[model samples]
Target chain A: MGQFFVFIKKEFYHIFRDRWTMIILLILPVIMLTLFGFAITTEVKNTKLGVFDPSKDIATRSIIQRLQANEYFILKKFISNPDRIEDEFQRGEVGLIIVFPEKFYENLLHTGEGQIQLITDGSDPNNAITLTNYATNIVASYQQELNKTAVIPYQIVPEIKLLYNPRLKGAYNFVPGIMGMILMLICAMMTSVAIAREKEKGTMELLLVSPMKPLVVILSKVVPYFFVSIINLATILLLSVYVLEVPVTGSLFWLIIISLIYIFLSLALGILISSLVNSQVVALLISGAVLMMPVLLLSGMIFPVESMPYLLQLLSNAVPARWFIMAIKKLMIKGLDVTSIYKELIILGSMAFFFIVVSLKTFKNRL
Target chain B: MQVIEAENLTKRFGKFTAVDSISFDVKEGEIFGFLGANGAGKTTAMRMLCGLIKPTSGQGIVAGYDIKKQSENVKANIGYMSQRFSIYEDLKVWENLRLFAGIYGIPNRKINDRIDELLKRLGFESEKDTLVKSLPLGWKQKLAFLVAIVHEPKVVFLDEPTGGVDPASRRQFWELIYEATDRGITVFVTTHYMEEAEYCNRVSIMVDGRIEAMDSPRNLKNKFEAESMDEVFHKLARKSTRTGD
Candidate 1:
């Protein structure tokens, strides 16, 4: 036990003594959280819209006013010529265009319906779809309000409810996902590279020849990283709550327990990687390519797993980050209990055991 | 007791045999020099004895532990200084010493005292607080050697411990090795310098994964009919390469 503490103390010194690694470990989580929180949004806002209203009437003006009233779109220009709409969208100055046809009020009075064309740039199809949907809802609501007084036997009412994310806040969705990715990268990737560095530098042989048992040496190397990863977890949670205003709906204790479990699994994975690879560069490349990329892409962090292709969905099931993201979402968004996440917990546990066993076996075989 | 005893020990990595069926014994409290050029099997044989690598087929006992079955025990009773100065460059000199000492389970007070003695003896007392990266290459090499033997293991393996040091520093380093051996610790060292082998009580010369010659420096010189150990080494190396074809 005394030897173990000594080894752990040395590991901490190695981590803290390097200014670059220390700075990166301390600052990266905060930077990524802030960037992803503010920049990634499911609810599109301040989108540029061009208006081509040829009918200069009161009703047409009222319809344009309703579109401008919504915060989702910012009215960029009112072009008299319809030909200018294509130029505005082509220059990327406008994401959406609203055209009110000639004699729009007269047609509405006579036919009880007016034609409005919504043209949106579909280069980024997801954003375009969102903007179009927002525009349609706003127009439908305005038409409904205008027709409220008329006694119509037939009416179409639209009911909408947001699933998964009710409030449609960007931070609420990204904070938990970023938390999982950052923890995994820090605990697994960093620790693996650090251990592989010892091997590359030929220090591992020196350490193995010492009286300390191999298990103790490995545990000591991982414990400091575990604590550092937890600190990052806390920092992200704090930033989410205070800076981004994302609420922690679940029990804080449960969140901590699950996050810690994931961190341990990541660290074990790092040790396993270190045992397999001989150089730090190889270890970093392997971890980033094999672990980090999949976590970011397939863990439902940036893209929904269900929305992905069939092959990707099947691939994501094998990624530990997917389970971590699911577990975190349940804890942070749904406020679920331990019992609710038993299946994810079991998978993470099995992965942790597998990595630990493989790493120990590799270590023994190398010796 | 023999610190190391190998009986026809061999190690093969795939089709390449790193350490062929070679046998030798290292007596207790003796400085055994393992001499070879680049690509020689000195490192592989040393690794097998240090329990860092397993032999493909053979029998050996290192520090009273079976080389095949009780490798962990063998590792516990030995110290290894690799060809590279493997000390942590980010750590201070004292921190490096304390870390190795702690890993060996030395008591804190004893570790402190031992570190103080070692620093003073090596004339590094003033640089104890400095990071190892700031130290000169020769100082780092010497410090690595000191740390390897700090736990006072029964046998210490030095793999090219003086590879890049200047003559004066090499002399100083050998002095420390001699001092450790005088304390009844066995020293198993490998070197490319033939002169360094002359200082060993017994020396083994390896070529193409086998020891072509093993004896004292004077005896090897007489057998090869050479004036110096260097001549003896060159003659054997050339003869082995000629026969290798």
Candidate 2:
């Protein structure tokens, strides 16, 4: 036990003593969270909208006023004819077009009914969806204002219930995903490079010949990274709650437990990579290039899994980060319990066990 | 007393045998020199004796432990320094000493004392604060040697320990080996420098994965009818056909 402590202290010194690694470990998570949360956002600002109002009446102008009052859109073009909507869309001059039909005001005043069509460019689905929703909300509010004074015999009233996120903010989605990403970065890539450095320097032989068992050597190398990742986890969680306003409505303790399990699995993977490679550059390349792309692209961190093809969806099932992102979303946003996250816990646990077994076997086999 | 005894210790990688049924004994407290050409099996035999790898078909005992059955025990009682200067270059000299000492299970209270003794004895008192990377090559080799045997193991293995050090430092390294042997620590040293073999109490020459000659440096020279151990080595190594390792 004392030996383990000594080894851990040595490992920590190695990590903290190197200024570059310390910077990456201590500051990189916060920087990434802040960057993604503030600078790199998916929420579109000043989206271009083309208004095609053939009615040229009071109700049409009121509807456009209501849409313009919101900050998400700017009326970039006013299409005189309905055919010009396609031209504006194709020219990329506008993302959406609102067409109020002819006699829109007269029909509304006489029968308390009118038709409004929303046409959006589908090239960018996320932008198109938001734009259409904004137009629908503006039209609905206009109808509500008219109904306060006028009589409408038949009305279609729809109530929207936002289950977890009433505001539907994008930061809430990325905070949990970023947590998984930064954990993988610190635990997997950093540790693999550190161990490979020992092998490159030929110190691994000295370690192997020492009385400290191989298991002890590997565990000691990974223990410091485990704690560092936990620190990263804590920092990211605090930023999500306090800065980004993404609360952990579920059990925070369970969230930490599952995340620790993930950190263990990532550290074991790092050791496994270290055992296979002999140089730090190769270790960095493997961990940084090979592992990073999959964690970013296939893990559904920034992209939705359902939107991917069938083959990719099946491929994502094999990515542990995808499940972790889902599990964290449940815990932080949806406020689910431990039973709700059991599947993710089981998968992460099995991965941790698998990596430990494989890395130990390879470590025994390799130099 | 023999600290290491190997009889018919063979290690075969598929069809090619690395150590071919060689037999030798290393006394408890003496420098035993192992010499070989580049492709010869000195490293393979040393690894087997250190219990880094199991022998294919042989019997061996190191530090009163079976090389195969008690591999971990053999490891616990021996130290190893590779030709690559296995010191952590990024670590300060004192920290390296501390790490190896800790690995050898030295008590925390005694670690600083062991380190101070080593620094004073190696004439490295001034370099206690220096990183191994900033030190000269000779000093690094010496510190690596000192750290390898810091646990006071019964036997220490040096595999081509003086490959790149200057002649002066090589001589100084041998003096450290003499100090280790005087303290009853067996030193199994491999070297490319033939003059280093003369310092050993006994020297064994390997050719084509087998021990071709084994005796004191003087006896081997006289028996080969050569003036020095260098000629004795050439006379035997000339028979080998295999190339670089």
Candidate 3:
């Protein structure tokens, strides 16, 4: 035990003495948090809006008032001629335009026929889709208000209700993903590189010839990286709560317990990688290409797994981060208790067990 | 008493025989030189003695512990210094010493005093806190040798410990080796430098994964009809069928 402590102290000295490693360990989490929180966002607000309403009737005016009153749009200008709509879009001053035909109110009241057009910049497809959806919802709501006084037969309206993230904030989605990514970054990548460094420098041979057990050497190497990962976890959670306004409404204790399990799995993976490779550059390449790439692309961090190809979705099931991110989303955003996340807990727990067993076996076998 | 005993110790990697049925013994407190050219199986044999690798087929004992069955005990009772710099370059002088001593299971109270004595003896009291990377290569090599034996093991294996040192530093390194032998510590060292072999009490020359000749340097010179250990080594190494590793 004393030997273990001494080895851990040496590991810390290695980390603290190197400026680049210190920066990566302590500051990179904050940078990733802010980058995901504020910089990369899907929620668009305060979009400049253009209008071409020739009738200027009370009904058209009410819809215009509703769009302006909401937070998504700003009334930039009213184009006079329909022919100039193309020129208005070419100016690029506004992202969306609304045009109501002449005699809109008269058509709706007397003949029960009205047409309103919503045009958006399709170059940015995601933004265009969101804007179109918001406009359609507002128009549907206005029609519903009209239908309350006069019943219209054979008119079907679909109701779409979002459950957990009602406002569709990107923070709610990415906070869990950032936790998965940063934990893997610190625990797996750093630990592997650190162990491989000893081998590369010939220090591992010295260590092997000593009285210390192989287990002690490996445990000591990972302990410091594990603590750093915990600090990163706290940084991510704190930033998500205070800065991004994403809260942990479920049991904090269970959330932490699950995160610790995932951390253990990552550490085991690091040991496995270090055992297979004898140099730091190879360790870094494997961790970056094999570990980080899967965590980023296939773990459902940036894309939905269900929408992917069948083979890819099957491959994602093997990624430990997918289970961790799923459980985190449940606990943080949906505010689900532990019972609701039993599937995720079981999957992550088994993966941790499997990785630890395989890594230990390979560690002993390789030497 | 023999500190290391090997009977037909052999290691094979697939079809390649790295160390083939080599047998040897070394008495306590003697500087036993392991001489070989590149890929002459010098490292492979040293690794087996230090309990770092498993022998394919052999009977061996290191520090009274069976190399195969009690490798942990063998490891505890032995010290090893490799051709490469084994100490952590980023760590301070004292930190490297303390780390190795602690790993060897030296009592906590004895480590500081031992470190102090080492630093003082090496005239490094003022540089205890200095990072090892900044030290001169010779000083680093000397420090590595000291750190390896901090626990006072029965046997110390040095694999080309003075590989790249200047002649003066190499001379001082041999003085340290003499000092270690005076303390009754058996030294097993490998070197490419022929003059360094003359300093060893006994020298063994390996050719083609086998020891061709082993005797006192004076005896080896008389038997081979050569004036220097270099001529004696070349006489045996010329029979090697294998190329450099």
Candidate 4:
């Protein structure tokens, strides 16, 4: 136990002594959380909206006011002619354009129906769709208000309520992903590189010749990295909750339990990678290619796994981050119970066991 | 008593034999020089004796423990230093010493005293808090040697420990080895330098994974009718067919 503590202390000294390593270990998580939370957001806020209100009637003006009322849209322009709407899009000033047809209130009041044309830049399909949806919701709410005052008894209003996250905040979606990514970065990448450094420096040879068991040495190397990942987990949780305003809605206890399992799995993967490779560069490359790419692309962190091709969806099952992100989304956002995430718990737990067993078996006790 | 004894010890990777049926013994407190060409299997044999690798066949005993079955016990009684600088460059000098001493199971109470004594002997008391990366390479190598034997092991294995040192540092390193042997610790060292062989009590020359000559440097020179150990080595190593490691 004393030897183990000494080894862990030496490992910590190695981590803290290097300026860049210390920065990457401690500061990288916060940077990534902030970057993913704010910069790479999917939520379309303050979209520049161009309007062509040809009718300029009271009802049209009221609907326009309703559109510009919320934080999601800001009316940027009022085009005089329909032909100029295309020019406004070409100017790249607005992502969406709402063209209220002539006699808009007349057609709506007398004929009991009106046609409003919504023109959007199709170059960015998703943003175009989101902006259109927000505009449609505003118009629908205006129609519903008109129904409340006037005696329109049979009109339909499809009340859309976004569950779990009502405002569709991107932070809620990425908080779990950032947690998975940050934990994997610290546990898998850092631990493998640390072990490979000992090999590259020829210190592993000296270590193996000592009375200390190789298992103890490996555990000692992993303990410091494990702690770093835990600290990162705390940082990510705190940032997401306090800074980004994405609270942990589910049981924090089960959330922590699952995260601990995922951390163990990542650390085991790091040990397994270190066992196969003998140099720091190779270890880093393998972990980056094998761990980072899958976590980013296949884990449904940034991309929805349901929309991916069938083969990629099948391949995503092998990525451990997929299950972790899923579980975190359920716990942190949906605020579900422990029974809701038993599948993720089992998969992550088994992966941790498998990696630990394989790494121990393949660990080179001899050279 | 023999601190290290190997009889017909061999190691094979796939079909290629690295150390082939080598046999030798080193008495306690003796400086045994293991001389070889680059790919001549000196490291493999040394690793087997140090209990870092298992021999493919035959037997090795280090400090009265079998290399194959009791490797852990063998490790407990032996120390190893490589040509590569093995100490942590990022750690402070005293931290490195304390780490190794603690890992070797030296008592926590005694580790500070051991570090102080070692630093005093090396005249490195002032540099105790200095990072090892800032130190000169010669000092790092010397410090590595001291830390390798910090547990006071029965035998110490040095694999080309003076590979890239200056002549003065190399001479000083030999003095350290002499000092270690005086304390009854067996020194099993491998080197490429022939002049260093003259300082060893017994020297063995290896060619193509087999010991070609084993005796004192004087006996090898007398038998080969050569003026120096370098010439004796050349006469024996010229018959080799092996290439790069």
Candidate 5:
């Protein structure tokens, strides 16, 4: 244990004394957190809106007021002529336009039905579709208020509630994915490059000839990365909660425990990679180009797994980040307990065990 | 006391043999030079004896431990230096000393003093805090040798320890090797420079994965009817099927 601590201290020296490594370890997490927090979103906010209310009646004004009061849209200018509505949208000044018909309030009072035109820029189909949904919901709420006392045919009513993320803020999803990605970056990539560096420098031969056991040497190399990964986890968590307003509704202790397990698995993968490759460049490339892309695409960070093709869904199972992200989402977003995530934890545990076994076997074969 | 004894030590990779049935013995407090042209199996034989790899078929004892069965024991009792500078270049001189000392099971209270004594004796006191990478190649090689034998092992194996060093630094490195042998640590070193073979008490020449000649320099010179080890090596190495040097 004393020797192991000494090795760990040297590993830390390697990390701290190098300026490039220190920058990557310290600054990369903040950059990735801010980037993912801001970029990863599909929900529209503060969209530019224009309205051409030709009727200008009480009901049409009331519906427009509801849309403007919400955080989804900022009412730009009112267009007097209908022709100018398209001109404004074409100028990129407005993402959506609300046009109330000439008899909007009269039709609502006498016939109990009205027409409201929702014209939107269709350059981005996704943005257009989401904006349309927002406009439709606002108009529907206004109609419900108008029909509070009116008797009509019996209708089936449905009530909906979102469980984990009530606000559906993108940061809630991104925070967990960031935790998975940053931990992999720090633990797996750093450790593999470190070990491969020793091999490339011929220091691994000196280590092999020493009295230090190979297992102890590998463990010592991983210790500093494991601690650094925890620091990154804390960084992402604090930033998400305090700055981004994404709260951790679950037990903080359980969240840390799961993250620690994930860090260990990543470190094991690093050891396995270092054992297989001899050059630091190869190690860096494999860990970055090979491991990182799968983590990014298949981990359900940017894309949902269920919506993917069936083949891709099966391929996602091979990505350790997929399970880690899933488990973290349940704990941080769903506020679930440890027992609730036994399946994900089991998969991560097995993967860690497999990597460790393969790494040890490779070391033994070399010996 | 023979510190290293090997007979019929062989290593094969698939169908090709890298080290073919080589044999040698070195006594305590001796400088045994391992001389070979490139691809002549000097490194392969040394690696087997150092317990870095298993020999295909051999009977060997290193520091009173079997090379095959008690390879771990052999490892514990031997120090190894490679052609490349093996010390941690990113670490300071004293920190590298502390790391090797700690791993070799040296006591904590003695580590600082040991490092201080090493620096003082080697006339490198001013470089205690300098990073190893900042030092010249010659200094790094010397430090690697010092670190390898930090535990005072029974024997030290050096693989081309002075490959790219200048003549002045090479002279200083040889002095350090002599100092180590005077303290009764067996020295097993491999070198490409035939002139270095003259400094060893006994030298062996390897050609085509086998030892073509093993004897004192003078005897080897007399047997080959050559004046220097370089000429002797040229005569024997000319018979090689691989390289007709």
Candidate 6:
């Protein structure tokens, strides 16, 4: 244990003395969290919408009012001629256009039905779909209000509620996910690279040939990183809670416990990677390509595993981050207890055990 | 008693043998040199003796520990310096000394005094607090050697420990090795420079994984009928390649 402490002190020196590594370890998490929090969002707001209202009727005006009130669309301009609608959309200024024919109200009064055209720029297919859906629902709601006073026997009523995030705050959803990704990247990749660096410099041979046991050496290398990762975790958590005003509905203790578990798994994975590869570059490539990418993609951080293809879903089972994200979301967002996420806990425990065992085996084999 | 003894020791990576069947013995407190060119199996044999690597088929005893069953025990009793300067670059000179001493389970109170003594002896007292990466290559090499022997192991294995340093630094390094031998610690070293071989009490020349010649430097020169160890090394190298072909 004393030897381990001394070794860990050296590892700390390695991290703190090097300017480049210090910058990477301390600055990267903040930059990544802020960039991902602001840039990547699921909610659509302030989309430019164009109107081609030839009807000049009260009912059509009411539908436009309802669309504007929802905050999903910003009224860019009104085009008198239909020909200019295509050009505005092509210029990328307009995301959607609402067109009502000249006799819209008259037709609705006589035949109880009117045609309203929704011309959307399909270039950004996701936003286009969302804008069209929003416009359709507003028009349906306006018609229902009209039908209440009118003698229309058949009416379609639209009721919409934005659940879970009524204000559509992007930070609330992304901050937790970014926490998991950044922690995993910092903890796993950094530790593995550090170990591989010692090997590359031939320092590891000196350590092994000393009186230090192999387990002590491995533990010492990982212990400093474990503490560094915890500091990063605390930084991210404080940023999300105080700076972003994101809620942690569950117990703070549980969140920390889970994060520590994931950190250990990542560190073990790094040690395993360092054992297999002899160079820092190869270790980085393996950590990023084999570990980080899968965590980012399949961990349900960006893509939901339930909606993914069957093979990808099956492959995601191998990624520890998937389970971590699930547990974090449940704890931070849903306020679930440890008992509520026992299965996720089990998966994390098993993965941590598996990685540690594999790393130890590989270390023994190499020595 | 023999500090190191090997018989028919061989190491094979798949079908390619890195160290062929060779036998040798080193008495306690002797400065034994394992000399060869690159890929001459000098490092392979040293690694086997230090217990960093296992021999595929062979028998050896290091520090009275069986090479087959007590490899870890052998490691515990030996100090090894690889070809590269293996000291931690980001650590201070004293910190590096403290870490190795700690690894050998040296008492904390003893470590401080020992580190101070070593820094003074190595003439690094002025730069003891500077990070090792800031030190010159020669200084780093000397510091690594000092750290390797700080624990006072039974034997120290130096693998090309003087490869890139200047001749003055190399001479200073040999002085340190002799100083350690004077304290009754055996020195098992490998080197490519034939001049350094002269400092060894006994030298073994390896060619293609097998020792072609083993003797004192004077005896080796006389047997090859050469005026210097360099000419003797050339004659043996040329003779071995011709036979291999």
| Model 2 chain B lowest lDDT segment of ten | B83-92
lDDT of each candidate versus the true structure: 0.86, 0.87, 0.91, 0.90, 0.87, 0.85
Model 6: CA > 4 A from native: A52-71, A81-83, A99-118, A133-155, A167-169, A250-254, A334-343, B7-21, B55-59, B208-210, B239-245
Candidate 5: tens digits of C-alpha lDDT, residues A98-155: 9988987887677656777899978899789778877887777776676676687122
Badly placed stretches (over 4 Å) of model 1 are: A40-43, A49-69, A76-117, A139-155, A164-167, A251-253, A334-342, B5-28, B38-40, B54-70, B207-212, B238-245
Q: Put down candidate 1 lDDT per residue, A165-264, tens digits, no spaces.
A: 6546777778878888898889888888998998998888888766567787788888889889978988998999889987788778878887877888
Better of 3 and 4 by DockQ: 4
The lowest-lDDT stretch of 10 consecutive residues in candidate 6 chain A is A153-162
| CAPRI tier of model 5 | high
Per-residue lDDT of model 6, residues B109-200, tens digit only: 89988888888888889998898888988889989988988878888888889998999999999998898898888999988788998999
- What is candidate 4's CA lDDT for residue A238? 89
Q: What's the residue-level lDDT of A249 in candidate 2?
A: 95
Ranking by DockQ: 4, 3, 5, 2, 6, 1
Please write out the lDDT profile of model 4 over residues B1-245, one tens digit for every residue: 99888999999999999999999999999999999999999988988888778899999889999999999899888988988969999989999889989888899899998889878878889999999999998999999998988888899999899988999999998998898888899999999899999999999999999999999999999999999999999999999999856
Best-to-worst ranking by TM-score = 4, 3, 5, 2, 1, 6
User: Which 10 residues in a row give candidate 3 chain A its minimum summed lDDT?
Assistant: A153-162
- Name the better of 1 and 2 by TM-score: 2
Q: Which candidate, 1 or 3, would have the higher DockQ against the true structure? A: 3
TM-scores of the candidates are 0.88, 0.91, 0.95, 0.97, 0.95, 0.88
Model 6 alpha-carbon miss at residue B107, Å:
1.0
List residue ranges in candidate 4 displaced over 4 A. Answer: A364-367
CA displacement after TM-score superposition, residue B28 of candidate 4 (Å): 1.6
lDDT tens per residue, model 4, A200-285: 99888888889888899999999999888888888899899899999999999999999999999999899999988899999999
CA error at residue B230 for candidate 5, angstroms: 0.8
